[model samples]
Target: MYEQISHSLLNDILNRIKPDIYQKDLRHFYTRLGANFYAIHGLFAKLYGNREDFDLQAQRLVETMARQYIKREDELKQLDIERERDYNWFLNQKWVGMALYANGFADDLKDMQSHLSYFQELGVNMVHIMPIMECPEGQSDGGYAVSNFREIDNRVGSLEDLRSLSEEMRSRDMLLAMDVVLNHTSDEHEWAEKARTGDSTYLEYYYTFESRNIPDMFEQSMLEVFPETAPGNFTWDEKIQRWVMTVFNNYQWDLNYNNPAVFIEMLDVILYWANQGADILRLDAVAFLWKKLGSTCQNEHEAHLILQLLKDCCQVTAPGVLFIAEAIVAPSEVTKYFGEDAVIAKECEIAYNATFMALLWDAVATKNANLLNQGIKSLPNKLERATWLNYVRCHDDIGLGFDDKDIIQSGYEPQSHRRFLIDYLTGRFENSFARGLPFAENIKTGDSRISGSLASLVGLQYAIETGDVDAQENSVKLILLLHSMILSFGGIPLLYYGDEIGTLNDDTYLDDPDKMDDNRWVHRPNIDWGKAEKRHTPCTVEYDIFNGLKKMITIRKEINVFSDFNNRELVDVGNPNLFVFNRFNPQKFHDRVLVVTNFNDQPQKLDLEDVASWGTYKQGQLFDLHTRQKPEIFNNTLVIPSFSFYWLREM
Candidate 1:
């Protein structure tokens, strides 16, 4: 990798390194830098070489890494060495995560530490504290509109509070994940303020233009992210007297990665948080990183290059830290977030499994696994080193992001199926159990998303409201069914904050003027400690879901096959209501686990001979790993109960 020109330039850059950085013990830093600098130099050159100051930018990037390495604490530095030796440590199945707001989960960062026992009780080891960074005073896109990248929001806690929380979580072997708004920032940010005052250097930080001539062209292919609220991609900034590309909303201006300085500055921001003890940084809105004309300005090739460069730089500084690409695109394009590598993820170590998530919802609406099986079979295989962040719900709307061709192949027209799902989930369809709400509904395009908490969307809320015991039990089974899928579907299962106790949608958002327009806030609930205490009671809904998921998580961690390493195989069981997949222990061939889920309200039967025909379970007595009991079989057929799944293995 040490080409003559690049390494010669790197030698000069290393020689120019500050004496303070050189005086420190940079043995591991230098070794990693030397190994990664060639790729770093190439990516930086590819991004900024035509500029006259490319060499200067290269020098700046190196020094940035050196300075950050010096700032990295001694304990974190030692942890980096340990992780580099155990490079695939993140892919372990023992890692279970939950996404929550610090204020929602507890009171703030200081209070979050006191509630660590709550997560431990639920078998969660990684806690993704959603977007606590400083944001604007009013309606801050639920904390997504980050105003200060390096400071925690005053409402949440002080920086010292967060550091203390991270330290405590590390002591307990728990991972701390925080958000970094990579694509855009609040209009009130310091950089945006400078741009408004007509500072050319700061203006270059964003995609601002004097006229709409270029923006109109860009608009021809760009799609509206928030079609109801923000109808266009570019917004007219009165203060700057210019149009800036605001992909998400008018108040959130997109950063221009075309500027190499922006890249280095963001890298510095990233390492700053890494030094704050964030184990994983979720890169928000990563799909919209690189914008281009005559295209959707998403999933561009240069975007991959930008991620690769960022990851390389991150490796040089904090090798232990990981990245979760929040690119909620289609299955065909989503895997690219992991980079174009067979065995290495040069872009990101993890990505959101949007397709899998959307498909699971479709199965919930239709009570069949035909589309779920078809959609998963069509999902492209991810890289060996990269894995997925599988979840039933999060702090967002459900987009039904499955491919149209998969719908057609599953015997349904694409648009009609989508409408049917929306109607059914929203309770507009006949006898629907869900109480979902509509979001971003568009009349012109007939496109919309559904928003509700997991409980509401799956009938727990409606069942409890109507006081139906059978229906309520069914809802509990469905809730556990969904969690079981994510827990065993070959990746880290990220349970949303309130889902552990079947927390229903919070309609109180309708009273808040700032949040009323956004129905997604209905699902971002405030954790109810009073109701959460019900989990300790045996006959409560909270008890069933919390205990069920805790058992599934414990079983998942005990099984080596659940560690994602390209070892899963989708099994076609010849029954439309059943979804079957096999997970094989990479270390032992005989230790295979067969997972079967039934998505019907009535019992479904799949013949044992057909499943064993593949020689997978031919030689063993089947036992449910979660239940520790043999599966019920009759006449050579296995019976899978309604709204239930089994992690079965040979006893």
Candidate 2:
């Protein structure tokens, strides 16, 4: 850390620091820079040492950090110091999160400011507001295609509104999470526009070429992200008459991270949001940050370097802020987003547990946890400092990205099982109550993902539509069962916006031309405050879900064992329908809670004899934490009801 070369570079950067930056009141900025200059210099050099203007660019990077730090509020600076003192504070079980779209969750950012009380009522301490950055109207991929990084989208609210909302959220001890589209920019973005005008310097910001000679090679190894819609990875810009690497869509051009200027610009954008009161910045499309020909253009070695560089830079500017890697790749690759380290998360502090979500859906459809268990077994252990953002549902399609070997180990054909899930959720399978739709269906590969709200995909929609009270009750239990797993799964459990109240799929997306093309919009519904009001009535469907989730959240917060200390142990109950796991304090193992779930429609018995060492057992004593009653165990067997879960502790 005290390398002479790095210190020398730091000294050089400090000497070149703008006089205007130092002339202003920048006590906190100078302190942070002094504390982190060594790491910053080292990472910057590693990333751009070969460039002729590396020193000049380094000066600009330092200036960007100083400018953003000066703009940050004094109270926020104090909050940052408090968070730094408690580095692992976010890993606590009490930090429940809810991810929502600003326009959909409320009317806009202003409306969201008023909903702070609602979040507090639900025991949510962190809220991830989906991308609100300025984007082209029709070209925006659900706000992923960012046209401007600094400006707020007018449809949501102004930058002032965001600051106000963030202030409100902070006052209530709730954290705000926002997105920064790191990998790509809208075709209408300034850089893209300049590239179109044949600006050679701007063209270097993206992967643009006059010939398809290199793009064709990359296509051979790269799989289509949107095979049915976007087709290939490259898109032709008629105005520029050049091929641009557009992995997601033609309107979204992938940023060239190999260029040092692009890297510095994105880092500035990241720090800008942190200064704007974003506690966590979810870096979008991180896996595709670096692209190399003859490879899949994802999970590349240089991609990790880019993230490492970015993380190091942020450590100097805003160490209190955390990064969420939005790389929904394979389980092995997903873990790497936390970075290759022994005890530290060099790349991101948090990463989405997309594999766990997909695996949970598999268990629901099959009425068993065989595949879930097998798939989880294959999941690599993450870095000690990093935690997962586990959730049952989010504003995205559920892609069955399970490992093929895990499917074989679970005694199922990989292709057929995936097909069965798609059919079951889409209502193509017999006796299936789910009314979901297929998304990104590739006819050649017969691969597709499912898209539907938590309630609709879980059969509550069909149950309510048919007026089947029993079916509805069972669906509600199923929803609670899934929530229980994420709650006790040794990580931060993230609830989607409307999942707590059983919001059904909105077919109205079919009426919107811009949204109808994307089936994922079916699940991304606007919150109905009127329907949400029914949560207070005990007998209402809204009441059942809302109160059930609220109770679960309260219970989860009370259990310290549920924190991310890697203290979970999977129990082999021998029954396929019974998924059992235990969470205990590593220091005091007896301070534990046993989580047992039944995926069956009938009563499933767990043999108490097999779990004697796993819990407190003297041949007969039983406890169910959720219901606050002794579970009936006859002849050393405990009965679990249909679609139910028990958070059992010692009686």
Candidate 3:
């Protein structure tokens, strides 16, 4: 296990270790650092080897990892060892996640602790609390624009509250996920403030130029991220009298990864949060980390290299900690975040399955699975150690980022089909009941994204306003149908905060001027304790949605084939109204479940003969696991009810 070059460098690094730092028990620390140091050194050299200060920076890199390893608590160290022994634990099906804002889900972190029972009641074991980092008031991009990396925003709670919450969560067998904004920081950050005063060293931390000559070269290939809102990729910094790269907002400045010092500093911040008891660190805006002229500056190869280096350094310090990539790009590009290795994930252990989420919405609008099945076939295979985080809707606008080739393959024109989706979701199309709104519409390109809650986008809002009992029941069934896919889709299903109770599009953000321009806030609602209590009341909208999800979650926990190990096979059923797939235990193919979901409002029949070889027959019969009863079979044809699904098992 010894590399001559890496071992020689490690010996030199240990010789320069500070005398004042205490290293009481570092047996596991030295062991892991030795195992991972070879890759860590090679990646660092690839990134910064050309610089004159390469040797000095290499010493600092090893020193930083050692310091963080020393700061790690004993309990966390033990967890790291236990996790290393069982490397694929996060891919287990027993884990269910929910993402929410710190204050939106509860008043603050202290109050969040009291609501732990609510999550347990719904069988959710993984919790992702959105950004509570210090950010500029009124300019925070929902806490993405961090003014300080080490301090928690006082409005949410202090660092002590986060540590306490992590402790309580571990006691209850739940995982804690926190955000660490990697691509940029607020202009008010300490380094930004120092750079404004003409400090050369601090100015290297950000991308600042003396003229528009360079930015102009960058603009030719880089499209605007927020075209209708921010309009450009560079901002004029009057304080420094220079142009600075601001990919997302003017107040947020992109960090210069070309500078080796900035890379080392961000690596320190990542380990800082890992030491704070964050089990999973969600790296935001990871796709835009590396920028190059005459290119889109997204999904760049350098970005993947940076992620690989960051993950290797994390392994040296906290092996148990995992990373979730927040890269919402094309399907082919998104899978790159998991690294190029065939057997293991060298970059991130998990990534958002945005393609599946967008495809599911397309099926809901067309009332068929033609595009859904076709689009899913184009989904790239992930690494063996990596899994997808599947969800229905989240706290962001839905961008129709499908590839044009896939649209053509599915028998639809690319441009017109996207326009039709916008028209349908926004209720501009004839008889369309969806109440979603168009967000960030670009007049030049005639393109826009849809923004609305899960309930409003799927006819629950319209059904309630019209007081149609039949539509209400259909909406409830459709809601369960969507949840059933993510649950049985061979990945970890992440439920949003308000989705369980059918919370509608909240227009309350319109009253707050700071949030009025952003339509995405409509879905990020404050938890209504009073209304949430109706889950216990039968025949209520809240009761129907809540109990439906609870029952599905319980059943998913009991299914052994649902764990993500690349054990899913998409069925090409002739019926376009039904989306069918097969899930089986990798070790035992005979133990399998055939999933059939109907997206149409009309009843559809799936013949058993279509899946005769799919699984072993048990007395020539199939059982519905969700209903705990045998499926209705009349002459070898299973008649699925309108907007229904079945987790059928045989043998």
What TM-score, to 2 decimals, does candidate 1 have? Answer: 0.98
Which candidate ranks first by lDDT, i.e. highest? 1
**For candidate 2, what is the total of clashing residue pairs?**
0
Comparison by lDDT, 1 against 2, better one: 1
lDDT of 3 by residue, 1-651 (tens): 447877788788878777644345667778877888888888887888899998789888877887888899989988999999999999899999999998998999989999999999999999999999999988688999999999999999999999999999999999999999999999999999999999999899999999999999999999888898898999999999999999999999999999989998999999999999999999999999999999999999889999999999999899999999999999999999999999788999999999999899898888999889888999998887999999998888888888888899989999999999999888888878788999999898779999999888888899999997887788788888999999999778999998999989999999999889888888899989888999999999999889989999999999989998998999886898999999998788678899999998899987767876663333347889999898877777888998899999873
| lDDT per residue (tens digit) for residues 1-651 in model 1 | 447778999999888887888898888888999899889988988889899998889999999998998999999998998999999999999999999999988989999999999999989999999999999998789998989999999999999999999999999999999999999999999999999999999999999988999999999999999989989999999988899999998899999999999999999999999999999999999889999999999999998999999999999999999999999999999999999888899999999998999999999989999999999999999899999999999998999888889999999999999999999889889989899998999988788899999999999888989999988999899999989899888888999999999999899999999899999999998899999999999999999999998899999999989999988989888898999999996678778889999999999987877775334333237889988888887766788999998888877
How many residue pairs clash in each candidate at the backbone level?
0, 0, 0
What is the C-alpha local distance difference test score of candidate 2? 0.88
**Model 1 lDDT vs. the true structure?**
0.92
TM-score of 2: 0.97
As for TM-score, the candidate ahead, 2 or 3, is 3
RMSD to the native, candidate 3?
1.6
TM-score of 3: 0.98
Itemize residue pairs with steric clashes in candidate 1.
Answer: none
Candidate 2 lDDT score at position 49: 80
